[model samples]
Target chain A: MKSIRGLLFTALLTGLIAAVALTGMSVYLRVLHELDVVFDYQLKEVAYAATMAHPDQLLLPLPSDSASYEREARLAVQIWKGDQLVYASNPKRPIPKQRQGLTTLYLDDRQPVMGWRVYTLYSKDKMIQVSQPLEARREVGIGMAWRSVRPLIVAAGFLVVLVLVSVSYGLRGLKRVASDISSRSATSLDPIEEAGLPREVVPLVHRINDLLNHLGHAFDAQHRFIADAAHELRTPLAVIQLQAQFLERNTDEKERAEAHRQLKGGVRRASHMVGQLLALARLEPEMGGSADEHLSLDDEAGEVVFDLKPLAEANGVNLALDTDTAWMIGDPEALRALIYNLVDNAIRYTPAGGTVAVTVRPSGVNALLQVTDTGPGIPPAERERVFERFYRLPGTSAGGSGLGLAIVKSALDKLNGTIALSAGEHGNGLKVTVSLPRAGEEPTEAPESG
Target chain B: MRLLLVEDDRMFGEALQQNLRLDGFTVDWVQTAEDAEVALSTAEYAVMLLDLGLPAKSGFDLLSEIRAQNNPQPIIVITARDARRDRIRGLDYGADDYQVKPFDSDELAARIRAVARRSVGRFSSLLAHGPVTMRHDTHEVTCHGKPVTLTAKEFAILAALMEKPGAILSQASLEDRLYGWGDEVASNAVEVHIHNLRKKLGKEFIRTVRGIGYKIGDNL
Candidate 1:
């Protein structure tokens, strides 16, 4: 490609140079033609004076005066009248047969010869013929042509340099884009928001941004699925551990009973985790084609489970729900997972006798689902990482596999919901607020919901 | 109380049955959802301890079928999965309560009795803890059978404390009970409720476990 561009540029430059040279040369040739006529006329004048000076001097080429005159004038003078042999300088020179007004003639050596311009002077009973060789005038005309073309040659050279410099500079944007895209890490799908220098590059930038958005979402889903799976596997192991412990120290029925109880709790934990994991995996957006995969997550808000207030009360945490019955379009199971996670996380972290209030409200077009807890609030810097899979708060002794918020975030993404973490009422605890699309939208109706 | 236990693990199920019998409850053990269904069809159980991971039919499916037949019997789901979603799911599908695996047998028994008693609509009497007794129906309190004068807020505080014998009740929880949703609660509302409850019920009834929450115990 580079060679092709270079060749094209060279061809254009050569053509332009040739055009200017040809134009200047033609004009110089025309001026030389006019000058040749004037030179021939002077020779005729000389011839006329000689013929008048002596009537019997017809065939008079051996004269030293005429020869010296011709040499001094830089013209080979010849005189021929009425088709007779003419007086010519250095008699070896041939004269034209068709004697008339000035015209070009060719010599035996192929040099151009100028035809004589005659003054017949019939009243004086004599004729005058004058001629000059065209070599000297031809040399001067060729010199003028070269002189006219020198500037054009230089200008064409400068133009080629300018074209090279500007074209390479203009192409730098493409090179920058290539480097930016190639150097990116496999998982970094963040879009490039900076505008390119040229308008022509905008389309490419937009396309890359779109691809990055899709890739980021895909990675998020994958991460959530893995975390959910790990959480699901933990419960059964906990159950096995409890049962083993019970068997190891079975001195009394009370101890065995306690082990059995612990085993049951572990099994429940494992099963619940597995169920949530499966749902999360299934709900993850498929690779590519995400734009059309509109998930109806808003309608699921009405599918409330057993009221959580009793559980909160039993745990000595306050549960206050402020929203009316609202619908969200998303997987009902996933929504339940998100809500349970938020509530569970609140209950676990809140000091006993501390309040955990859950409120669902209408925020603009979307539903605002918030869970506020009177626990120690997450720091601003760490708030973003709390959504990552298996990320638990730093100092809480709460017993959890750490998939709660991860599942919530995964589900929220499917619903195109937004979540924000901020300080709670007293600015002493964490408040997680989420916004989900309103129910009954066409995107929320999943084909498999039935 | 007679309890029916549906579990797939034979050893664990048998052990649980034996232990529950010793804990003053007549226990019936089954290994599959099908057997549990048949037994439940004919027997009367005060509470059903259902394991969700049963063979042949999942415990959830059995519970759904049972609920479809208009059975409102208290069912507590027992599973090894500790995910909050699963517990809510089980409850959403009509299970009464959920308990994770590796739990204490005493705690399980306590939950069952509490659920079973509530299911049987036995909320007319007072719940007595040490010298403090709070009548559920009338929302009245008595100490050593002596009439105890308490405000509505103080009564709620003491009721929350008495409900969970050894468990801690966070100050936030007490305040939530006192105020409804959207009702602005002062920051020190729970402290005030605790102070009022102490003045009426004696200071030792509610123990302040600093940095955690408040707890009530029989020793207090």
Candidate 2:
């Protein structure tokens, strides 16, 4: 992992090093230039002194500071009279004679350096040259530059240390956040603490808290759903218990057989309740499984009818389905579940010899599927409430789970469909009309929960 | 005892009715608060089993209405709503007891007996008269320290008379203890049950006034 603190500290230290190196090089160059002026003056002064002593020729004395210059570099002097070498001091390597001005010379071929800076003076047919090595000046320049830049390097080092400390302090918020999150249990979806957070990190925390809010809502809904399912199953369970007791109480063969049948029915009801609950739960969180499938609603409806034909027959309800090319885009399994619940509710509510007809056709560029039952229709005041989970109509004696309409609504919402409930054609039963935009036409907007 | 069971779920109501009937309770099961109101106005009951989640009208409102009218029949709320607030609300609205659903039938029967006993100012489950003692919980009847064999209907008739020793019990009221709303009752059914009770517990065990109802044979 790339740490913010490490990255910042390294960057600051590199900048300090580069700056310090540039300062040192410029100081070295400036010192070398200044030394050239001072050394050239000394060379001129020495040349004049040599010229002043030139009348003595071969017995001329050196300059008063010549001893010190010799210790540092080999200081040499020469005099030329009428272009002939007249006087020489330490003459093994002579200073090259030049036109009367200062010049650098390579006195020997054995050395790699520019050997000397020589000053030449011409007076009254005699030339005097005073010279020194360039090596000594370079060493002094380096010492002066080092002395000047040492404190700057120390200050830069201190700055780098200070930067590292502040960088780590600035990053403390992120560390606190990581530790805070890691210490919490997975079930706690509370918002991250934002107190004392850096400004740069506040937005990120806000977005995370928003996500946590959504997760909390989803979990609450799941919990409520589970509780409601358990609560609803109890009614069927209570009936099963009673039927079992009734089975134990009856002595006659026929009565026992009847009780046994009722007991089986109760078990079947509870099992159906469980199946519907699983379907509802799966569909509750973000469009259960695959939500996009190109299929015909009429075809799915036919499959649902085929599946529920046995249940309808058992209830003595005459089931009918009229199909057409009412195509739509939806999850095939969800559509099947939606159709099954509607048909099952109709069959359960309709009395014996009653008819439940499902018709599919296109209505106004939209596919419309209708389930009409010859049973008691919902009162207009209670029509809106029938879609609530676990809401049953008053005085209706069917052993329905009260989740049928709710499941249909859930699936319809996912498919971007609309449902309308009204009285059937004869005005004595319920007609549930569901309309969805066909697959080929202009698409609908994204689904929103009802 | 006669009980009025108000529940919206049909199968649950039927199953509970069957079981309570086997427990020697004449159960009048209704699926709506409106039907319950009608049943309450027409006949009195020993106890009422109410469910809170009724369609069109909730049982909570029905309970408040029942209490407002000062109907003093013992009410036991049997519902799937197990939340504490709901339980408190049901009891506060004058229910004799609150029972969560999927409960044991035997426990429900025992509660019914206890509430009925409490309502009638009787602390004990046994109804005693002269030489006979009847245990409603166990359905046991004894006379002179010896157990007596009696059918459920015979036991019910004897219990009704012994419940209030000197009080007269109308034939119709006694029939309510033996039959539910749909049970077919012969015209001479009460007479036949009384004759058989007399034969088993001695001919003078039950006494009848010529123009009124019957009472127990002897005073306490």
Candidate 3:
């Protein structure tokens, strides 16, 4: 994997190297130009020195050929008195008289070479000239430029090492966090420790820790739900097993007939529990957030009441619906589950000849649904606890999986709605009120609806 | 045997009561702990089947109450709570046995019989006196090595008498053992059953104590 430390180190190193190279070249050219100017000045000084000398002294040639070979090859001084050569540093070759000023000229026609930087000045009847080979000046200029750039090359090497070390040090915390995460077990959702972290990485660590906290809660809830579901399923299965055993042992036709009936009843209860469990699982928050369409709360309530009317009649509970056109945005199946559970719970808890009434209508910009039943209402303390999964009111003889209100609560959560349970009229019954946001309404009404 | 069943689920409780009745047990089923407590105080049960979850009062509270009152009725806990802690708590609270729900009916019946046997200080399902032998599980009785069929009521009465051989049992006590709370019995039902049992088993198998009740003679 490409590491952040490596990327930073490489980028800094490349930038430094480019900067060093650019500065090195510019410094070399500047040093070379300065060196040329200094050399020309020295040449002019040499001509002036010669011009200051006596005329007899200017006419003298070199003392010996061997001693003058190296010096004469690089520097040639010559003097002329009215077109006559009076002094020459190399007597074997005649010096050319050039204009009286600094100038450049090639020395040999057969072997071409950049010849000289010559300085000539006139003194009375004499011309004093000083010249140096262009090659020699170029060599000196390059040597001074190298001296200036050598230190920069050494500093560039040092900078590369420094960048690598500091980048690694700055990124150690990130590596530690990565390893800590990789070493954890799959079931571990503990928050990552954030101590001693760099400020650059603090926000990332905080986000990860938050995610872990949420995951831990989700996992815990899932485990509890599975355990409760299994526990609930065991009772009816035991009943079925006991009934099966009764059928196996009983020989009397009358006794066998009763056992058969009970066995069927056990199966039915188990099947119903299974169905409710599936509905609850499907309504979980994680499974929600799919596309929702505009649905009429009144129409949904009417359908639920129509379907449960036969059940209400069988139990001798009066069921009624009072509703108007109330539209909402929600999943149809989830809304059905919500309505079904509310009405079912009411009918089951209400006594024979009791009343269960449902109402749905638009109040302001919110769709309000109310279910009032002349049944024993939940106590103030138990109203909140009833939404817990598989939690049944103690001493209640109702035959349910205890998932009805829990399912209702989950559905309401999916619909972005709120539910409140309070005492009904005269404090003799339970009243459940649910409010959902109206579709195609201004968001200004949402806060009030909630 | 007469058993008390305390459970909150109406359908499961009714089915279990019916199944227990078919297994030759007269079961009185109550949907709440309050009713169970009332039944326990008012009547005698051979065993009590308790469920942990109830409408108002938990079965655990009822079990504790029964124990605190020094009631010696054997109780078998039948519940949906199968956790180890719940099992330990139920047994530690003085239940004779513990069974998780979805349990085999045969296993539960056998456990009930075992607990009842321990309570009565008897270890066998067979109750034998003279030439008659009855197997509780099969509800089969044989006289002089020949199988004989008896009505459920007659069988119940004979089993009650044979439970304590040579001990006089009043008609009321025998009727309690032969029927549940809602069953209606004729005034001479026990007498008619004893008469039929005597005719079928043999004339001298059971003896009637004048104005008291009936018994099986030990010397027969």
Candidate 4:
């Protein structure tokens, strides 16, 4: 992984160096061109100066002294009369004259001098020319250009350092967020602190905090659920233990038989509790995902009633279903569990010769499912509390883990439905009414299939 | 021993009652704290097995009531609430011993006997008089270093007499200890058991009181 500082520094430095180099090149070429123009003007002036001098003086051969040698190395002066060379600044090199204003000619006759820029002026019976080596002109132009561009190279280096430091400073908040998350305990779901966060990273922090909030709630719910399950399992286990003790110590055959029967009953109750707990866990709202299958609530309820008929018969309770074809979009398994819990609860609570009736029918744009039982109903004040997990009403004789209504409520919530418990027919028992939107209606929320 | 059991869970309470009966205890089981309070006020119990989650009033409230009334019936709390704080609270509320649910019924019986013995200013389950030693756990009696096998009724009668040495116990009280509700007893059942016990052990073991019932001689 590339460090943000390194990446930013590299990119900015590359751009700065490219810009400096291009600007330097353009400045050097422009200065060189200007120097050429000035040199040509100076050449014309020197040729004019030579023309103004006496023709005899221009023709005199200059001696090769140190000062004169330096002057001749840079500048070459020549006089031509009638296309014949009368005089030259370097006697070993004869100048070749160009047509007029500015020309370049290689003075290679000396085998060492490379090139020259020459200018000529014409007067009556006198033609004077002045030239300078091209190497000398370039040396002056580039020397001055270097003086102008040296600061830009230095500034580019400084800019790279500044960008690196600033980029690292800007990215410190991201590193802090990473370390904060990494150092946290696995069980800790607390939100990350957002104070003093960079503007670019605040949205990320907010999203992470939101996820932590949800996770914390989910963990808390799981913990509470496990605690409640353990507490609910204790009583039945205690009953089984005591029954086994009774069976072990009793010598009377009748008492032993009774103990054996109670032991079996205790095992059955414990098994039922475990099954209900698993059903409740499976019907959790978060477990549902994209339930798009269309199922009939009437058919689902009929199946649940058929399955629970034996239980109702064993308890001597009359179980009946009066339902029509009512279609709704939901998970078949969850819907079945919902109906089973309600009917099973009703049958378990109702006395012998009592009745438990289930009905499902379409009402307008909604499907209504109801279970009415002739059992001792929950009081109006305690009806809502009964839906809480593992909460059994005091003094009730029905053997239950108290997760039946809770499971029903959770399933209904997942299906985007509503439930209400009120007095049964004739106002003597419990009637649970559930309403769900019919298929093809605008759903409150799409149900997720398990 | 007579014990009062206060528990709301019907199956658990009934099963625990049956086990305690088999352990040679006359258990009066009540389903609510209110009924427990009433029973405690009316009867004498050797110890009480109290469950915390009750219908009307909780066992905690009943424990406070019992302690406030100076009732020292050696209450042993048997509850499903096994949190450390709950156990501390139960003990603080004057419970003599605490047992959590799903506990071994034999262990509970042993603890009951231990607490019952402590209430009577004894520290051991073994009742020794002269050469006779009765082990409560195994219900085995030894006389002169020889094991003596006794019927359950005979053991119950001997245990009742050994509970308070030299204290006169009425025939009705002995009958109460020997039988629970619905157990058919002949009118001379205590006499028949006493006769058999005398024949098996020795005539000098149990002494008959003239107007009272019977007593074990303190003299070895």
Give interface RMSD, every candidate, in order. Answer: 11.5, 1.2, 2.2, 1.3
Best by TM-score: 2
What tens-digit string does per-residue lDDT give for candidate 4 at A1-450? Answer: 976776787788789878877877888899889988888887887788787787677655533225743353377788889889888876665767767667888767685547888887787887878778888777776677788888988988888887777777877888899999999999999899899889999999999999999999999999989888888899999888888877887889987888889899999999999999988888876665646578889888998999999999999999999998888997777787788889999998899999999999899989999999999988998988889997789888467888999999988877888999999988988999999889853345768889
Mark the regions of model 1 whose C-alpha exceeds 4 Å error after superposition: A2-12, A15-23, A26-123, A131-298, A304-340, A343-363, A370-398, A406-433, A437-450, B1-220
Model 1, position A314: C-alpha lDDT score: 77
Which is the better candidate, 1 or 4, if ranked by DockQ? 4
DockQ, all candidates in order: 0.06, 0.66, 0.52, 0.61
Ranking by TM-score: 2, 4, 3, 1
Q: lDDT scores for all predictions?
A: 0.68, 0.85, 0.85, 0.85
lDDT of 4 at A301: 91
Residue A441 in model 4: shift from native, Å? Answer: 12
Supply candidate 3's per-residue lDDT for A109. 75
**Angstrom error at residue B169, model 3:** 8.2
Best by DockQ: 2
Using TM-score as the yardstick, the better of models 1 and 2 is: 2
Error of 1 at A176 (Å): 13
The alpha-carbon lDDT assigned to residue B156 of candidate 2 equals 78
All candidates' TM-scores?
A: 0.40, 0.83, 0.79, 0.82
Those runs of model 3 whose alpha carbons end farther than 4 Å from true positions after fitting are A29-41, A44-96, A101-116, A121-126, A133-142, A243-265, A440-450, B33-46, B55-73, B83-96, B118-136, B139-220
Residue lDDT tens for model 3, A1-450: 997767877887788778877776787778768867887887777678778877666566533325633343366678888888777875654557889788887878775565677888998878887777877766665666677778977887888788878778878888899999999999999888899889999899999999999999999999999988998898878778777877887788987897788789778888989999999999988776545877889988999999999999999999999998888888888899999999999999999999999999898879999999999999999999999888888767566888999999999988888999999889989999999988763234444553
